[model samples]
Target: MDGTREMKDSKQLISNIQAQYPRLSKGQKLIAQYILSNYDKVAFMTACKLGETVGVSESTVVRFANALGYSGYPKLQDALQELIKNRLTTVQRVEMANEYSDDTTILNKVLKSDIDNIRGTLEEVDEKAFEEASNKLLNARKIYILGMRSSFTVAQYLGFYLDIILDSVHIIRMDMGDAFEQIVRINENDVVVAISFPRYSKKSFEVVSYAKEKGAHVISLTDSIFAPVASIADNVLLVKSNMASFVDSLVPALSISNALIISVGMKEKEEIKEHFDDLEKIWKMYSVYE
Candidate 1:
């Protein structure tokens, strides 16, 4: 689907709570109070856990979500998470991480959460957008890879693989000057693949807007349809990188990149095989590896 949908206002969750607070059941009021005071923890909790903490039954928690105009608890939880994701500070993030430090099974907890993120991504991904992104990447006269902060790692990974398979792939670098300088040459025949997640880089929107104005195809790799990058993109690839601690889990982001790369790489399999064969010979000659 084209990424032109109106951005959902996450703050509406707050207004909903305030308007409904007085009408809520006694147990629901307790839930609302905890959420206002400690949303970071509430965002990560299951409906059952939230109910227990708020002195209510799990069914009561579900009812609270419905009272807030959400169809279900998950929807309400998502609103809470989105509301706080970008507003979190470094100290707050560290505190979020400390919530798990007392557990002996932290490793299992983290891995399972990442696994769930991958599953959610698979369930919600737009196949049409994925295909469009792949086709655009293949046909572009040139490709610009853009990301910043933690997102840079995903951009770098995608750029590395795409460069090996496509001769026109270029990663936009911040160190070289302004981010716009690298993409100033973009045109209608070019494609811009930009990645951004919660705590998104403002630079992403600026660069992407400029590229779109210049007539380039824009592909956004991000966590939500509400993300600023998604609104300006020609294709939006949604992936869940749910928080595992202070940082988001990038396993889902990398998984989608792997899928996109393999999809594009297979189309040029014969040429890629020859290129790799030549690289293997050069590597062996130079003793690049033991």
Candidate 2:
């Protein structure tokens, strides 16, 4: 179904604010105006900071988010961030980072944020979906993994280990030419693992669209349920990746990839031993490692 009907576009936030604008109190009106004028900036600001910047109380910002139908200020901020993620420039990202530069030491803050991301992801990840995706990988006739930009690293990591433990694994790369060229033979027996996070790559969505059209089983790993690829996926695994600075946080996503790899290995126990044994023989014969 592609979840298009269920998709929440940036328009939803804007329209919600506009629709309720006339009825808003003076304080809420200030927030609405500020958000409408400076969403990219506000996306990175905490509710308290946003309120202070606009000469309102912190509670006003919370109520304003609630009035717009968001569950809380963080959700509202997240929605705003989603709207700008794909469009934000490096300079804009750096500017946003400057807002919190003095909060704590860079090293400590970054590490703590990653810890929170993983902890949040662990709490929210759907167990049934993870198991189902694992089963698909185990049973697939052929497996194709796709990701672009920052996500490409994660795809490579997953593909590396899976190639050793499984048969017919293909990692899609668009470097030489069209990535589709590699997946041209994909069919119902094939499984496509698509990874994309905030500031998603359109190419990833294109690959998912093609896989779906060909009746391939599709599994998506993304930070949000509303992520574009989520609609078409047979199973969706959500990984938490709260924004911190100019760089996209991918540690949690990589951790999920590791979990997937280990799960597949556990299920097949003895089946993949011979594959590794033969590969080790080739490595030793060629002195691949000292």
Candidate 3:
């Protein structure tokens, strides 16, 4: 893709969840705003140095990429590289990199930027919307988890934790074809917690769309209001997780998932008890309970 197409793709990842992203923390929000405003710069930075410049840990950079539906920092960089290589002339790209050359001052600047982002996120988060989404998870008959690439980790985590609290939590982490096949089992009583961030993986969106079509309630975690999954989502939880770097972070997104899991745990404490009771028997049989 040309630079314009690449930039458009980057924008699409974040814009798709813009409305919901503001619920993230101040630092995470800072990262999100930075990515949007300085995407051209980020198309080239290494994850480690990117985190340093953004005043966040390297893990945060990796998490940020995960937040955006990338498997990790390298994948986000690939997307950035695609944008940079196809979008800008070599000379122009070089000129742009020189403009934001990493410096000690970047730390302070990134901190201030994140603070601003957090404030904005706080202002934009829809409390009632989040509550309604959580309620949906608590009441749903089956909870289906959809995520791919970077999002797969979050989906797996949610599925594992939610399973302890409720029965029938399904996670699709393999091929897109397999995911499509699994959603066929969804029904009116099922709810899908679908996660897709920047570079918003096409497969993730497809799964959400499929689940919705099957009459499953969909909850989305994405970066922007216009996130592709939002339109089909029954509820959306947004996380602001941009920073001045190449990678997108997942801390905020994971935090959102954790919150939902906690809510489910609270609502179905008895189910958790039964789930653990069965697990203990397996643990003893496997010598894990010694």
lDDT of each: 0.87, 0.85, 0.69
TM agreement with the true structure for every prediction: 0.91, 0.85, 0.60
lDDT for model 1: 0.87
By TM-score, the best candidate is 1
How accurate locally is residue 12 in candidate 2, as Cα lDDT from 0 to 100?
78
lDDT, ranked from best to worst = 1, 2, 3
Model 2: per-residue Cα lDDT at residue 153: 93
lDDT of 1 by residue, 1-290 (tens): 11121125456778778889999999999999999888878888989989888889999999998787676787777777777887788678777775476566678778888998998789779999999999999888999999898899999999999999998999888887998888888899999999999888888899999999999999999988878999999999988877747788888999999999999999889999999999999999999989
Candidate 2 residue-wise lDDT, 140-227, digit = tens: 9999999988888999999999988898998898785798888889999999999998677778898789989999999999987668
Q: Best-fitting candidate, measured by lDDT?
A: 1
Clashes of each: 0, 0, 30
Candidate 3: residue 68 Cα off by (Å): 28
Worst 10 residues of 2 by lDDT: 1-10
1-290, model 3: which lDDT tens digit per residue? Answer: 33223334654665733653666566556666777777677765778767777788878878776666666676576465444443454456446535355676666655654664455345545677788887887888888888887778888888888877776777886854577787777888888888886667777787787788889888888766556897788776766555444345566677777877887677777877787899999998899954
| Model 3 weakest lDDT span, ten residues long | 1-10
